[model samples]
Structure formats: C-alpha cells, structure tokens
Target: MELKSNWSKTGRISQNLLALTLLLLPLVFLLLVVLLPLWTMLQQTDPESYHMVWQDDFMRRQLGWTTIQAGISTFITLLLGVPVAWFITRIQFRGREWVLRLIMLPFVMPTLVAAMGILALFGAQGMLWRGWDDTPYLLLYGNVFFNLPVMVRAAYQGLCQVPANRLYAAQTLGANIWQRFVRVEWPQMRPWLSGAMCLVFIYCFSGFGLALLLGGERYGTLEVQIYQLIAYELDMAQAGVLVVWALSITLIAGLLYAVISKRTTFKATVQVLPPKTPSAGQKLGLALALVLLLLCCAMPILALGWRAISAGSSWQVLLEEDTWQALFNTIRFTVLAMALALLLGFCHAALAHRWAWVRSITFLPFMASPVCVSFGLLLCYPDYTASLSMLIATYALLAYPFITKDVLAAWDSLPVQYEQAARTLGAKNWQVLLFVTLPLLRPALQRGLALAAATCVGEFAATLFLSRPEWQTLTTLIYHYLGIAGQDNYDRAMVLTLILMLVAILIFSLLEWCTARKEKSLC
Candidate 1:
C-alpha cells in the first residue's frame, strides 16, 4: 500500500508537470523572440554609458517632466473614475448598458489611434486649441480620455458584487444616507477603490503612445527613451537600461499596489440580497447617465466618421485595392492573435490549477509598455517586412495574461467531476477534450477571443517598432500620418482612426448579440 501510494504521488506529479510544460511553451516562444534578445542587450551593452545619458541636464529635466505628467494623469484618472463607478453601480439609472460599453471604448482602441482622436480634439493645432497657453494640456485630457473609462469598469465590477441588503438594512435601522454610505457601502468598496487606483496608475505611468504623441519631444520617459535610443541614437546600452529601469519601477509599483490593495474578507454573516428592481428616482438618474455616456462616446466617434467621409482624401486612398488588402491584413492579425491568446489562455488555466509556481509569471506585453517589448524584438528582427509571423508572436505575448486570467477564472468555477465523468466513460484524453472540455469552455473562449481580436486591431506601439514600410498595417499607417505635420495629416489619420474603431465596435456588437442569443436560448 505504501509503495502504491508512492507511485500515485509520482504519477500525479508527472501529470502536473505535463500541463505546466504545455502552458509554458508559448512563453518560451516569447523568450526566443522577446526576452532572449533583451538579455543579450543587457549583457553586451556597457554599464558606463547609462551614466552619460543620466548626467545630461536636459535629459534629466525631460525625465522629471515625464514622471510628473504620468503621476498627475494617474491621480486624475482615479479621482474621476471612482465617482463615475460609484454612481453607475450604486445609483439607479437609464441606459446603463450604454454607459458600461462607453467606459470600455477606450480600453479597446489602440493607444496610438486613440491618441490621434485625442490630438484632433486637443493638440496644439487641434480643433479645440485656442492658443490660450504655450503648452497644451494633452497630458491631462489624453489621460482622462483613456484612463477614466478603465477605472469605471473595474470599480463598477467591484461595486456590483456588494450585497444591496446591507445598504437598505442600514437605511431601515435609522441611519441617514451619509451614515449608510459611510458604513455599509464605503467599507465594502474599499477593495475596488484600491485596485482600480493601482491599475489606473500602472497604465498611465507606463503608457507609451499618449506620452509620445502628446509630449512633442518636450517630455521623455523610460518607455519613450527605449524607442528614441534605438531609432535616433542607436544606443543599445541606453535603450537596455531604460527597459530594465521601467520594468523595475513598474514591478515595484505593482507589488506595492497588490499588497496594499488586497482586502481581507471574513467568512461569516452572509448578507442576503433582495430582488433587484429600479425605482422612479433610479430611472431619472439612469436618464442622466445615458446622456453622459452619449457625450463621452458620440463626439469622438462622430468626429472620426466625419473625417473618414469628408477629409478631402482621394477615392484611391479611401477605396483602392490596397485599402482592401490592408483590411485583410488587419483581420488576419486579429484572428491570429485571438487564436494564440486562446491557446495560451487555456493552458494557463490548466497549469495554474496543478502548480502554484505557474501563477508567478506576468510577461503580458500589453500590460507593459509595448514600445519596450517590441523594441526588444526590433533589435533582433530589423527586417520586419511582413507581420504574419512576427506580429503573431508579438500579439500572443501581449494578449496572454488577459485571455488566461479570464479563462482561468471561468474554468475554476466549473466542477472537476465533469472531466472525470467523461474520462470514466471510456473517453480518451483528446476525445474528452474535444467532446467535454471544449464545449464546456466555449462561452468564455468566445468572449476571450473577441477581446483579444479587439486588442490586436488597435495595437500600435510595438507595431511602430517592428513594422517595416513594405507591409505596414493600418495602425502603423495611421501613426505615420499623425506624426508628420502637414495639410490633411490629422484629417487622414482621422479617416483610418474611424475605420479601426468601427471595426472594433462592430465586432464587439456581434459578440454582445451572440451572448444575448445564448442567454435567451438557455432561458
């Protein structure tokens, strides 16, 4: 019996090891394409050169301004985001669905394309620019534009999970609105507030495209410096240091955020929730919420659509065969990215179950500054003519954490007996996966893939590094137009920007419809 138990333990270890190895395969590909080159650059580059870049007064000032801008934007996004979240979740409102979607809009837009839209609205020569001050406040407006919605969604998700009975019971117990909110609502929402603030801070501080387009060489960060050193200065050492330095700062900040943000929940006194039904006041509040959603979403999108239509662009530029080809390229990248993300996500979920060690790695390129990761790839693959293989690899690296985390969450929610029952019924492993596992996981897989495709379509920072002129995708083209100062530059950028955003919205709408149909069928 002892010998049999020892064999069972070894068999279990072997099974877990197999899952871990499979899960790690994609990351290994990333190491070959992304991390290996990074290690080489760091080891080969001279340490002495970093001091030279640091010692320059102008460089130091630029660094200071960059840090200050990012910090300010982070704080502002949090301030604005928390209130919107609180209102949306706690207060009853109309058109809440529209508001939720609007908040997720910026999250889907590629940072560069979003930057173009923001530029058209608020840059030095932007439509809203009045020359009121020498420096435009792109840092603030741009930050709020992208970061606010993110905070809303995260915080709102947290708020929605709270028990409503607690608030109402507090009201019944002679507590005023202020007391009810302070004691019942605020205490429960502490987790989300901390997490959302930390997440928003991480995004703004490490943002690459907004900082680049808005800064106008006036500000430089560890992210921007990574690109400049490679493109302008050709200093691998400085570029390497910047990458390592940015990673360190972000890692430290993330660690601190996670530590501080974790909320301790005691497993006791479960609060029963009442049936949810909105009141007249809630209806009025919802109407106002819908108006706010329209204001936030409609203008920028309408601006882009108008530009695409009446920006004086030639029919050839608008409807040529190349335009069709470019659309194909975009779809191709989107599909491939989703596929890779799904595979990685599935593996991550499986391995995370069996091995605690597997949960430790977070090399999602999207989470970090895309410029840093892509440039690391750029140093190795200079001749990036076609994005087929190179871009797929990059997309997989970036989309991994998002797809994996969501899938893992959904998978863990399921019962283990489902798999075991199939296995006992004369089903081989592959057969079980095909018949039992895949179908059970279909909904989450669909949702994850939709998100991955949307994310890949808007990706530009890394593309900026890896894209060559010959086969440059739509996003890189949009970035090129935005960067060049000329007549109709903004106009043309707007044209492509509208196309990209529409593509994402259409895909998102389709997913929503599909999910709705699935729910209705079950009902």
Candidate 2:
C-alpha cells in the first residue's frame, strides 16, 4: 500500500511539472518576444516626446479619426453582415456552400493586395469611375471589404446555435419572422456579433498597410503616423508615444472581446434547422444580398486580374531572379513562423483550458499592431533587427493568437466525458490527451493553423520594418513596385499582388485539405 501511494504521489508530481512546463513555455516566449521589447522601447523613449505628441494637432486629429472611422466601419459591417448572414442561413440556394467558403477570402487577403484591389476599382485611376478622390471613404471601403466576412461568419455561427425547436415553438405561438428573430435569435447572436465587431474595430484602428497605401496625408490613421515617425523621421521616441496610445485602445477592445466571448460560451446543439427553400420574396432578398456581396467582395479580385492582364509585360516580372527570391523568402518565412506559432498556440490553448485567465493573455499580441511589434523588436534588439530569426519571431507573435483563440474556443466546446472515459479505462493523462483530446480538436486546429499560415504569408508591416533588402517578401516587393514611377512598375505591382494573393489562397487550401485527409485516415 505504501509503495502504491508513493507511485501515485510521483505521478502527481510529474503531472504538475508537465503543466508548469506548458504554462511557462508560452509565458516565457511572450516575455522575450513581446514584453521585453515593449519595455525596452519604453525605456528608450524620451519623456518629452509624449508631451510633443499630445501638443501636436495633427497627432490628436489622427487619434480621433482612427476612433471615428473604426466606429463607423464596425456599425456599417454589422448592418450589412447580419442581414446577409441571415439570408445565407435561412434560405436554400444554388452555390450556397461555395459562397460561404469564398466570403472568407477577403479576410485572409494581404493588405497590399486588398489596397491594390480597392485602387483598381475606385482610386484616382480607377477603372470603374475616374472621378473618385483619395479620401477616408476609400479607407472605409477597404475596412468593410476585409471585415464584412468576419462579421457574417460570426453571426452565422451564432445563428446556427439557436435550436430549431425554439423557432418552431415561436412560430406556433403566432410569432412573426421579425418577432422570432428578435426574441429567440437576437439574444444568442448578440454575443458573437458583438465580439466580432470588437475585433473588426481593433483591426481597423491599428491597420498599417491599408492606411499607408490608401489614406493620403490628411486621412492617415495613427498607425501610418507611427510608421512615418519611425521610418522617415527617425523619431523612435515620438513613435513610442503613439504606440502606447494605440496599444491602450486596442488592448481595451481586445479585452472586451475576450470578456464577451467567455461570458457567452456556446455549446454545439444537435437540433439545428436545415436550410429551407426560399419563398418568392425571400428569393428576391437573397438575390439582392448575393449581388451586393459579390460586388463588394468579388469585384476587387476581378479588377486586380483585369489590371494585371491589361499591363501585358507585367506578367514577365514573374520570371525575374528578384521575384523568385522574394517568393522563396515568403514561403520559407511562413513555414518557420507557422511552426513557432503552432507551438505557442498549442501550449497556450492547453494551459488556458485549465485556467481561464490564461485565455486573456492570448489577446496581448492583438494590442500591438505588426508595425509596432517590429519597431519594438528593432528598438529592443538592434543587432538582430536584420536577422532572419527576429523576422520569423515577429511573424509568429502576430499570428499565434489566431490559433490560440480558435483552439481555446474548441476546448470550451469539447465534451469532458471522453477524457473521463479514457481515464476510467486506465489511460494516463498524456495518453488521453494524445489519443482522445487531439482527434476531437483537429477541426479547430486546422482552422487556427490555416489563419496563422495566411497571416505569416501575407504579413506586410513586419517584413517592411524588419527585413533587409535580401529578405524582401512579395508584399515588400509589391510596395517597392508601387513606390517607383511609370506604367511598368504599376503593372508589375498588380501582377505581384496577384501572385501573392494566389500564394495565400493556396496555403489556406492546402492546410484545409491536409487536415481533411488526416481526419479521413483516422476515421
């Protein structure tokens, strides 16, 4: 009996050590990559720089504009996304599944590509309209283009959670469609929609590439100003002040999202309603929604293709040594960054399952924009600023949260009995985790990894800030093309943007396919 007790105690000790290791791995990575750099940047900042930034009217206006635009974008996205998501959910139509899948394309698109797409359709040289000016309207359009799908998907998922039986009961009680939605569906969907809006706001507020490319001097966000201060003016102190403000606002928004998400934990319901054939009015509404969605999301991609094709010799750039080198760098960096992100995400998600507070820590990366993160890395590790390791780490920091957030959600939704049953049959903790928990979490892991991969592949701000000339990725190359004069450069930029878009899409598709195959084999 004493020997058995000793064995049990030893097992407990080993389990505690393993748990501690998992907890410390992610925390230490965050400490080294995120916290330490931030601290270093703060230490290097001049105290008077804060006062200078505060006194500057331009800086103050940028801050206000950032907030205002983010608010406006979020409001418009909600208004448009909810109705479209409802239409997609309630009505059966041709190509419905494809529509759902393709809508996510905009969210994963590189900012430069998205910016180019907007320009192709609506800029000064816009193909559709020649009268358009560079305004906040362009920036707003870009924001909606990128974020509308996110809101739609979130609302769709929330709507899916509503039991069909509840809707039936509401209808039987003589509740109209609007009343059914307001009383039965709205309460459930509110949490998901609200959480998605917070994320959209953060993305818009801290966005660097779109603002830099589209928002001219008068309309640029604080992020663009920070880039100007650091890159052009060599004023790290002033940039630090702006970074602090951006971080504070984004941190608050991220925290609100985390709180709302946690408070409204959703479980899978077995009684979801299947899509019904649409009535004549419903069909008309669905048609209108699809047309608007296609125009908003798909036209940008079409415009880019046409622009590239019209450029003629632009396609020839693909054969250049520089183009191939950038492509290789892009792929290599994405692979390395994705590996690190997966490690950090897995550890963080596993730990968060045990302690809910750990989940909030995943939001830390979202608080700082990619440009800010790269700047902090540059300030903190001056020697390593040009190193491949630093560049990969920056990409990982900006991406791992996507994987962590998704996995954490999956963890919350996962049933507990499977693990309990495994343990009852004498399976050890590690065995249960490997054999039981992981298989069930595959779908979430695939989604997270796909997002992480797309993020690393499409990363623009960090690469621009941290990479050397030799380390240029496709995004940086596209930016370079944009900076040069003449029609050839413009054409080259369009062609390269198309290539970059293809790379991102292929990576996402490949990951999804691989995961799907793995699930089939396991089954």
Q: How many clashes would you count in candidate 1?
A: 2
Compared with the true structure, what per-residue lDDT tens digits does model 1 show for residues 236-350? Answer: 7767766766666666656555454334222223453432455686556556655654545345555556556777753245665656666777777778877777777777767
For candidate 2, give the lDDT of residue 232. 93
Judged by TM-score, which candidate is best? 2
How would you encode candidate 2's per-residue C-alpha lDDT over 1-523 as one tens digit per residue?
Answer: 9999999999899998977887679899889888999898889877667766568888888899999999999999999999999999999999997887677888898888899998999987788975556578888989998899999999998999899999999999999989999999999899999899999999999998889888888889999999889889998778898888888899899899888878556676548878999999999999999987987788888999889889887789999999999999999999999999998998999888888788788788987889778888888888897898999888999899989888888888878888999999999888998999988888779989998898899899988888999998999999999999988999999999999999999988887777767767867
lDDT, candidates in the order shown: 0.66, 0.88
Model 1 lDDT at residue 181? 61
lDDT of 1 at 106: 67
Give residue 340's lDDT in candidate 2 (0 to 100): 90
| Error in Å for residue 161 of model 1 | 1.8
For model 2, which pairs clash? none
RMSD of each: 4.8, 2.3
